[model samples]
Target: MKLRVENFGPISYADVEIKPLTVLIGKNNAGKSMLAQLIFTLMTLTEGYIPRRFLTSMLQHIRTTEDFIAPYLRQVDDLRKKIKEAREITHLSCVKMVVDMIIEYLTQYLNKTLGDFLERYFAMELKSLVNLYSDYTRVECAYSKYSIAEFTITKDGNLSAKFDIKMMDELIDNILKDEETNKLINRVIRSRGGRDFTSTIAAIEKIAEFIFPKRPLLSTLYIPAGRAGLLEGYEAVSSALIALASTAPLKGISVPPIPGMAYEFYSLLLQLTGRKGPFEKMSDLFKEVIEGEIVFEELKLPKSKMVYRFKFKDKESSVDLIHAASMVKELSPIYLVLRELVDKGYLLIIEEPESHLHPAAQVKLMEIFAQLVNEGLEILITTHSDILLRKLAHLVMEGLTGGRANANLKPEDVAVYLLKPDEKGYVTREVNILEEMPTFDEVIEQLYEEERNLCYLSLQREMNEASPRNF
Candidate 1:
């Protein structure tokens, strides 16, 4: 896939072609994330699995928890004000009479502002004090003496008043003296504390905002390569199932035998080895195991193993489909699944594959990506690691070494691009590897030697100046 981005944040206009393993190298704030989002958006559209209406509908309703809390508290204050005014200095007959009037006003306000069903309309829990006011032990109202701004209510009852924060606070304090009602209100406020429905809905809506073709899930996975030993082996089997389910061509394929079905077969084989891979002991009580024939040879196990006999006896090769060990062993299931997608011609946008991975593993990752190219996959990746860039350079050179083996192209096929910041606070690139081939190992070695000689000369000059006799 080719990407042409214009007026997209820091990238004013970028025209880049993607290969099997496209590596984007640049400094921070160079619009890498922007490019990644663009690819994700494109993938959602191309798959035809996402609906566009959901995106627009979602973006229109992005709100935070704070957005809900602020307005709710304000409404509570308003309700308190009306209740206080009806009780104090207004010749309102009895406390209950004032309470009834306030209740009517409150219900009226809720009906008008909250629109019939408060819960359904607000999308958050709203507990009103007036609903529980009859249970209060005492109800009192206190009016403030100072009158800063004034409005008139004529015989026709046309009235208005200037807003006063002090008057509002006093009115609220007076109505809050109803101990039972106050308790209920406090309980409601505390119970509904830290509400995040607004924020969560907002985020979901934001996801729906872009002209998306369908409502495909947008989530992230973190791979901790620094602790590969901690990676559970069964995770690989489950990941394969997820990959198969997500693929458009294999969308209906379920893990007919739910995941971890590989464990029983692995356990049977482990009995022959006498020693298991630590995780093999977890297969006991797997009675729900689906019966299937799995090829031992395809898994690349020892041919001399007694399990070889089991491979010959079978009817259906069901278990073999879930045995992803051969396809993904050392790599984490997340990367393994992603790798399979890339290898099968899917567009993959990866962020920071260098995290926790060894230098050698990083290099081999590039090799796997090249292998995917051979298998017809398109990939775009944003990386911050220098080692990753170096590895990519090495792979390009290696591809060149293959020469005519690749019927369609030459050594200059893979392109490398760099993004730089411009004066207008936009990102521009001075060199693009795709447009011009980056210096191969030969040119790099020459540059390294020249820098080494300069470094040695600088050290010699510093040493001469340090001599006491010369001073």
Candidate 2:
């Protein structure tokens, strides 16, 4: 998907295409996290099985076939007539009708979900989302040739979003032409002697796949900065909520507002289950990086409590995650979330994945990320670490050289964008991940030149001193 933004938060302009392993590199307060959160919000808006839920309700609410079919008939009159005639229903126009109806409902759904997510993610600083100098702000995510999700913020703080139906039509048309969908459509057509609700439901479910593909899920998650601190606090709050058996009392007390992503992660931690996800074994990668494993263990000796314990390779015993090292705390969520919740289709947005890690560890972490992408996991990260970027470049080169294909990254698989402040506001530009990492200040380059010049000057002085006649 291509994400375009104008005057969003501190961002003046950004047009980026998200790849499998996307990275946002920039200085502080450059609107990297804001942009990431915006993407997260849009994906979350469409999360869950939107089609199934809406269709179930629609079926319940519609008293007759006309109540449901009349709205879309205008756009697909030919297709409807063909179905009624029991002819081969091969019209692509039905895809358009389905997409339009989906967007109609999606717009209504997003009006509230979008606002709630913004409030949670931005912490009630809605005005700050608009650029002060600009008349309006716009954010859009376009898939295929058309935009599916878009947001607009006027200078007066009026917020609205438009979800266009002109998205993935061609792709959905192909899906509608699939053999299974074709059979389902034919079955519905043959049973047209009244509203065969069962066949109609099945046909619409197939049509719904046009709007919501099964490959990449609509749900996306964000891993915020200072995750170690946040996770430590989340652990404490989990216990308090369990002990109190209600969060009503805590609501009255004043506490810092946690961003929506952190809060969501906290909630996810509370929902640990015994059934493992498809990617559960990926936790071993994190264990290698942290040199320890953070295991979710339940203790019933004292009382039933869920605890996260960090166990090192060399150690015989494990300690609670809060008492573990900062690096361990920072990485535990990555492990837990991967091993517990998400599978290949979920996009994981990590604000600063390299936080509180050594240089070598950060490099190893990059390899892990590359391997994960190669293994079909999607990741979007915001980083200021040159080590990670350089290592990524190396991996890309390795991919080119046909070495380490397992942990390798193709140039197309990785997209690095440079987000930095301009005179007016922060602007984003796509960077070449395979090239030398871009440096904002070039301080390191200047120091390297200075060192080279100093070395030459020292050599010249020694030669002059050795040559007594020249002196």
Candidate 3:
């Protein structure tokens, strides 16, 4: 399934779709993370969980209970003002009453995130989405398109902000009536640092879990970038994954297991050639059931320094949640582990898979992603790396002309979406990026410029000699 965002933050109105493997690429602060956060929030919301906590740990200045609640209050106030001035209608009208009821329901928790303060409110949001599909299978949603505030931290530790949503919603009133409108609101208001404002986050969590079918935990690794000590930064990942893991608790196998010798050999093959096994063609690991494999490394005492590790073997690896990796070493496994998962029908939502890695590694990671699409895993990645985009372009071309081609895959399936800034400065995202690639002449000129720059750096361009002719 693909996702489309219109008039949302940093975007005026853009439409983009993600087939199986989608890549979001852009410059720093160009709304890449925002797009990821938005989708991630929706994923959590649909699954029925409080997701604001996940974002707070990642963003600076968004830590703490009040930080989360503040934004929700502002949004609620905006919604309240609009409803109060709603068009003249009888109190009993379904539209009027629902609006009135929402207001009354919300006033009870004045200055609070409705989701965090009221259980019924949270449930109501979920009920809206599920009920919409139940009530109208063909319903469409319009984002309220609220302008996001341009926030900056003052020298004294306070935040300065500004917003402009005039071009955003086109019509805020229309947004309220749309069925999916509430889902969007619920997703945003309950995002990082949004829970303290509303108490119903727990209930929202419940609704999400109930509606969306849980895709089993395919072999995947959870990694977080190093900020402070291991213990300091790891908790955020642990909590987020734990929140996700709670949905599909492991039954027969242990919650986290170390990989067997076979699993390791399998992972190594992919790492070496950016391709998975031919072990069947080269070794016996493909035929035997390699037993007694440990997939997880324990967090020892003074665990602050502990890092997780796991592996998969050649030919025998399949999509099973039998392996585990720590948040510290997320990259090593996200790329390699995900291919195996997707090949077996697992959907992976990886957060900032590029964090803490070299530019070259970042590009290689995309090559691995192309491999996954070739194998068929539904992969969704949220990133802000330009190299990753170049890699995606290179790989998409390869998929169109190589042994890696799969009948089920499409170039669009491995799309590169961009989350950009709009007039209001709220984040907005668009896909179909490769379609926007530079023209051949433009590419040649860019390459020529790069070569010229290199010559200058090496002191190889003579002052007396004219530059080479342009072809």
Task: Judging by lDDT against the true structure, name the best candidate.
Answer: 2
Pairs of residues clashing in candidate 2 = none
Q: Write the per-residue lDDT of candidate 1 for residues 241-352, one digit (tens) a residue.
A: 5467657355555455421213322332223322222222221111112121222333445333222111212443323322323222223333323422112435555555
Name the candidate that leads on TM-score. Answer: 2
User: Hey, what RMSD does candidate 2 come out at?
Assistant: 5.6
Q: How do the residues 1-471 of candidate 2 rate in per-residue lDDT, one tens digit apiece?
A: 788999988899999888899999888888888888887776666654344544555658855455344433332343345456644334354444445555765576567567667877677556668888788888887743544778887877677887775636566757666988777666655564235555555566666566555444434767788888987788578666565556656667444555667777777667666356788777578878889777668878677966778888888799988899999888877778788777886788998899999999999999999888887888999998888888889999999999977888899988999987888798998888665577633757888999999999999999988997875
Q: What are the TM-scores, per candidate, against the unseen true structure?
A: 0.36, 0.83, 0.41
Q: Give the TM-score of candidate 2.
A: 0.83
lDDT of 1: 0.39
Q: What does the lDDT come to for candidate 3?
A: 0.40
RMSD of each: 23.9, 5.6, 16.4
Off by over 4 Å in 3: 1-9, 49-232, 235-328, 332-346, 356-364, 374-376, 405-409, 426-471
Q: Rank the candidates by lDDT, best first.
A: 2, 3, 1
Better of 1 and 2 by lDDT: 2
**Comparison by TM-score, 1 against 3, better one:** 3
Better of 2 and 3 by TM-score: 2
